[model samples]
Target: MNMLNVSSNAFMIAFFLYCGAFIVHAIAVMGRKFSNREPEAHVKKWGRFGLILTLIGLGSQLVYFFTRWAGSGHIPVSNMYEFMTFLSMMVIVAFAILYMIYKTSLLGLFALPITIILMAYAAVFPQEVQPLVPSLKSIWLNIHVTLAALGESFFAVGFAAGLMYLLRTVKFDSSAKVDKRQQKWLEFTLVVIIIVIGFIGTVFAFRASGYEAVFVQQQVTDVDTGGTNDSKIEKVIYHMPPLVAPHNSDTESYTSFLGMKEPLFEAPSWMNGVNAGRKLNTVLWSVISGLLLYGVLRLIIRKPLSRALSPYLADIDPDDLDEISYRAIAIGFPIFTLGALIFAMIWAEIAWGRFWGWDPKEVWALITWLYYSAYLHLRLSKGWQGRNSAWLAVLGFLIVMFTLVGVNLIIAGLHSYAGTE
Candidate 1:
């Protein structure tokens, strides 16, 4: 069979393995619910099984990526499908690390489904092999793309942990009889919401402000050897090749179809000079709007912010959540800095002929890196811990998500190969 077919088949096998693991985890959880005691052995067995399956799935995914790289003669993250695969793999690796550290079987239950969803999403996008254009043929391709994926994956795990922290802190009245079934259900619901909101926010933000193109227009005037300008002049428009669609097609049409019908649309006037300003604006608005909505909903539910916080106040030692958040960030921050910033710059220099061109992807990656670095610095220097750290962790993940998925989807730049068609 061809490489593509091989990759597809491997992915299918991995998908099944993940699905089986998911079911086993569910069964383990159910066993715990029925017994009103931890199904320690069963949970442990299932967790190990799930981890093994995930490892196998991870191997299969690597094979798929390698085959695709061989087939295309470049990195696999040149489109949406590849990025999803990359994202899934990164998350799985991150989950494995966390599992090793915390020894929490519950994380497997949460993380496996997310990995499956991402892999499934990848399946829906196109998987055809296309030749790498002139721009993508750089050694930096691997470093920049891989590091960015790794950083995002770390953030994804942090988000999952944050959700878990939130769920573990839920209050259901120990004074009044709490229904075991209902409590479990509520816990599950809360975990799902935290994960979903974190994921969605990051995804949306990344989509809005991640990849961008900057145009530099040069006015070329014919000059004599003496350096006196002649009347003849030409306007030469130069810019980095767009990483994705509208810009790619537009550039092609502008250069190739000069006098013919303009087949591509100009960027909206509001978006003309600002590069990725519109997308950045969209992300800002989204964050603000989401926070506002959450506030309003909280207000409606409890009639007062103080009362709404009372349950959390009573059940959660914000200090513990803050410590967990700090620890996760401390662990993830260096990995992110190394992968997203240092390695990416090295790759950029090799691939794009510049180590730091402020390409949208580069810019966003730096922003993410700086945000986390700041988080670490704040925690260490300013004694910013607990609730403050947790909030920053949440925000840091948001920034990381934007750098990973958002830049590829929303912004336009050299990373176009990482987008959906």
Candidate 2:
């Protein structure tokens, strides 16, 4: 097989390996209650097995990265699929390093699933190798993207550790106002994560069923030389049924879903984005599917998810969890500053002749940086630790994610080129 084929096969292998590792880690954490098994020994033995599997998966993914780079004749970080996969790989690297340091099975229980979700999310985007656009042709593309993703990966690990700390410590049945509020917000955070997983599931379901819809939007542009408007028609395609149609557009083709042949609503005239309507429809479906999934899980568990999982983590030390979360973010923060801000500005100067344009993506990146900066300040100087620090770590990752995904979907700017078509 060709290197590209080899890369694809290797990627699949890595994904399966990661999945296996997650399952084994789950067993390691949860199987302690089984008959005749000492909890500590069971955890250590199975955690070692899980760690071995994870390392092998990481190695296989590295092969996928290099082979794809070889086959594509450029770095594979040019598009969403490649970048997300690379980010997932880096997350595994970070997780493994933390695992070695802490030797905590609970960390793997959270981290491996996240890595799996990222890999799956990457699959939701187009994976075909595409040539680098003019702006992405610099060596800084390699430096900026890899470093940014690497830093983000450490943040991901921080998020996992922080979340673990919360789950281990949060009082699910508390009657106090402070405790109740934390419960509600933690539940909301879990719901949001489920919603993301729902998005992946919804996309894959319709895509597998061969569902299709198409719209043609006519956009009028102002001309500088001529005293007239120039009209351009853009064709937008959806892999799922549309609940929201594009503004000022006619349906070129559409498939009925649940007896609905037309869009439920039109996108607002002001909502001019790259496939804004389709994206909005996707958001709607994700919310619906995610809620449904959460509901199903709730039914199965018959308790708050936090409560259901908290017992497994009872043996874990909350202070250690807090320390892991803080250390990961502390390591990630400076790297993020260097990559997402410093190298990014240098790249922008070279490509756009300006260092900072206040573009939506750039603005959000700045927002993320400032948010994390505040997080560190509060953590070190203002004495924010334990629950407060965990909350910041969790929320900080959310901001990072919004900067990565939400801005690309909702806003139109110079960085829109980085988004999927």
Model 2 lDDT-worst window of ten: 412-421
Q: What is the lDDT of candidate 2?
A: 0.90
List TM-scores for all candidates, in order: 0.63, 0.96
Writing each residue's lDDT as its tens digit, candidate 1 over 1-421 gives 3877787777788778778877776555444545555557766767677677778878887888787677666778767788788888887888777778776555565567767867765654567766666666777566666766776776666655555454445344443444344345444444334444443454444345542333332223447687876342222232212222222112322322224333223343344323343243344444554566555666678543323433433333444445545665667677777777787777666666778897898888777777887877888999876445555765666676566556775777777663343
Which sections of candidate 2 miss by over 4 Å?
A: 35-37, 224-228
lDDT of 2 by residue, 1-421 (tens): 3999999999999999999999999889888777375778998899899999999999999999999999998898888789889999999988988888887887888888889999999899888888888999999999998999988999999999999999999988789999999988999999999999999999999999999999999887778767788889999898989999988999999899999979999999877753888888889999999999999999999988877878888777899999999988888889989999999999999999999999998999899889989999998999999999999999999998888777766777777655365
Please count the clashing residue pairs in each candidate, in the order shown. 14, 0
Evaluate model 1: give its TM-score.
0.63
Error of 1 at 385 (Å): 4.2
